[model samples]
Target: MTGATTLFTGRITRRSMSGLIIAVLLVTPLEAFAYDNPIVTGTVPLRAGLLLLILLGLRTTRITAVEAGQLFLAQALLSMATWSVLLDFDPNRIAVQTLAYGTILPVCTLLIAPKATRRRWAFLVFCVTLYPAVVRLTPENLGLLAQVIATLLVHGASVAALDTHADRAELAGEMADIDPLTGLLNRRAALNELARGVDRSADDQRSAAIVLLDLDHFKQLNDTLGHEAGDDTLRHVAHVLAAFVRPTDHVCRWGGEEFLVVLPDADEALAIDMAERLRLRLVDVGVTASFGVAEVEAADTVTSWVRRADDAMYVAKHEGRNTVHVARRTDRLTVERPGALGAP
Candidate 1:
């Protein structure tokens, strides 16, 4: 495996082990919870063990933002389940734990540097879970609720702050390659994505499609609605395009309000059809886009392929604001450029 892959694996495994430890050392002890009346005299260990395994499973896999959200939600749910097992049927414990856990999610996401896997989200949730159970002396710790909540929030807020810092740190290196307002991949990212698409197509022997889209009368929208609104409009359009794209496909905010869509395994005809679909789809959003699409030639260079698509997009703009044009390049590796090499 590559060094990067090995590093990712190491990180994931480390997190998984930590989660296992938490389940064993901390949560398990809580099973003999109520001093005289054990929360789950026999089943406590079993529940903790199950949670450990599940946490391990999640930490071992690749993570995504959506999964992160679900993990936090799941952790809050699990905390409630754990509370049910406690001998004390204190609604406050259940309410405080569940509500606090829920409230802490966005804060957790904002604070924590994402784990290399989906498990990080779970970790944050687990943290919130452990807090109320540990902090609240008993169900009726009413007077202490404010203090406890304050401490937890402080901790959670700290995590959110840390996460924000980490996200900014990660963004620093790639900031030059992403659109500032919309956070879409920029021109540089598009170039890198183009090379990646071609490599995948060559390896898999599949067709790759490229589409260049430019918003119609985008300036007018800015003029009419204001730049802030224009920015929101741009973000909305990005969400739409992102929804349309497959995970295997690449979509970049090419420049300004223009976008580059790369569809791997799609031929010229297929590329054009998808481009047309984009054109029509934009109407629903009260904005229009023009598209220029191309298929990866046998040995096409980035310049050659992109120039054709770029030209086609203008052609579409000339014919009509919302339309598609198709083009094809016959050569690859025809230009000298940075990061253009086809081999490692």
Candidate 2:
């Protein structure tokens, strides 16, 4: 299977595991209650183990923030409803149920929810499960308020700790796919996007273009104006490219002094126009770049398409900077340099 199919299958597996674990946790207590088997204290440990497994499985799967939030909410409601029915309105069991619902459910949800939405989801779970329990406490049972308070404190601290972990994981993922200097997609992410674009173009019978850009005299600027200024110039160029491109386009920092723009559904003429527009925009910022444009072809692979653009870019560099070159798929060896007919 392809990488995408594998990823999709893995995600489905993780989600299935999560659902199974949730079902087991929810049903196990009810089963013990139904059978009146007090020896089944293994519920906690079993649930804890399953929750850990689900968390571990999530490390490789991608779940959206909204989905995570919804999962937490569902877990909270299921736990509350299950405990309420299993305890059969016993006042003595209220404290135990409160502790379990407040602590276990929030911990599980926080572990699964996205870091950015963890706190909100935690608070939501708490209010949904614990607040009602606290409100239902009679005046004669006021002493149980202390247990509720302690559980709240523990849940709060757990959410904070889990949120910290989520933030760190998110930051690591971001750093992996992001170029620090220009804030554009890094090489690995760009290649992934290229593969996706190739698939999309092939499946839809539409053309896509790759524009390879190299800033002219970037090395001289770095030498004379210091690396900081060169960094700023790179960022400015990135901004210009981003501003000029459509939302369907992707911009990536291919490497030092070079950037790649992937334009979906664009033909050779359209790609040349985009490159020229980008070149003119950079000129407004007192910088110039060479652009190599190539359209996708029926038999073209990612490497061949990018190499075509790279070859055209070299032609632009040779002819003179601040120009655009077109490399068509029909002519692999011919580099349509700037000033050539139909060149930008």
Candidate 3:
């Protein structure tokens, strides 16, 4: 729904900007004739043709919104400069142009710098829009001074409004991806990330693995200790998993008391070793978790890959809990218990 709304809004914005440009093109010739300025009249054909070409390019080419806005803004600024020169820098006309761009340019700057460089670009645009009015400022035309103040206020307001909106949108997206209880990636977000990781692993011919951990006796803990203690245990387990994993790894609450940890660039051996370490760490926190480790295979889908790890986890639970089991590519199982030979 959000994607559809964004697409619809983009179409509307494109059409509106196109319509505005065409309207300006249609009006330029009328203004040239009405003013009867020799230079304006003489250059009408050339200027109109240039604008029409730009509009045509906007329609025929694939360009981002920022690029399109920039083309239109460049044309508008050029036309304003041309008219001012043709009219001998008429103070009234310059003031009008300054006011018009003071509004238009800042909006375009919003499109141009939607991210980190927004303030820098806005500052530059505000100075550029203010240049003409500054040169025309005098005691007699102190209204130009008023125009400067208005431009500054408008520019500042635009930046503040956009920053607030962007921040909220970002926060909302993060919240959507997070688990409410554990503050880890929820099942849905984890699956999406796993899919991407699988694709990357296939493309790069690198190894990737998933460790599925299930807290032992979690239901009994909830029933006996009450739900609050269960929730605390879940949060504590999530923190330990997060702290134990490498920076490239992903820790997710895979529903209920099950957690999935994605390990990129790791083989079966590494996966089992990591799982063993995680089991020991959970024990340190006075919690015991059954772990299953499965390295990704060439023909494995995300579902099948996670299923293999999950199957291995159950094997650990069956082997008297608090142990790690590895899923080999051939679907063979190696039950690894703590203190076993070749075990960490």
Task: Tell me the TM-score of each prediction against the true structure.
Answer: 0.47, 0.56, 0.55
Q: What tens-digit string does per-residue lDDT give for candidate 2 at 241-319?
A: 8777886688899999999998877888888998998888888889988888998887778898888888888777877
RMSD (CA, Å), candidate 3 to true, equals 10.7
Q: In angstroms, give how far residue 226 of model 2 lies from its true place.
A: 7.0
Alpha-carbon error at 342 in model 3, in Å?
A: 29
Evaluated with TM-score, which candidate comes out highest? 2
Of the candidates numbered 1 and 2, which has the greater lDDT value?
2
> Clashes in model 3: which pairs?
none
Candidate 2 — which residues are off by over 4 angstroms? 1-121, 140-156, 172-180, 183-185, 192-210, 217-232, 242-250, 262-276, 294-305, 315-328, 335-344
Candidate 2 TM-score versus the reference: 0.56
Which 10 successive residues of model 2 have the least lDDT summed? 1-10
For each candidate, the alpha-carbon lDDT, in order, equals: 0.63, 0.71, 0.76
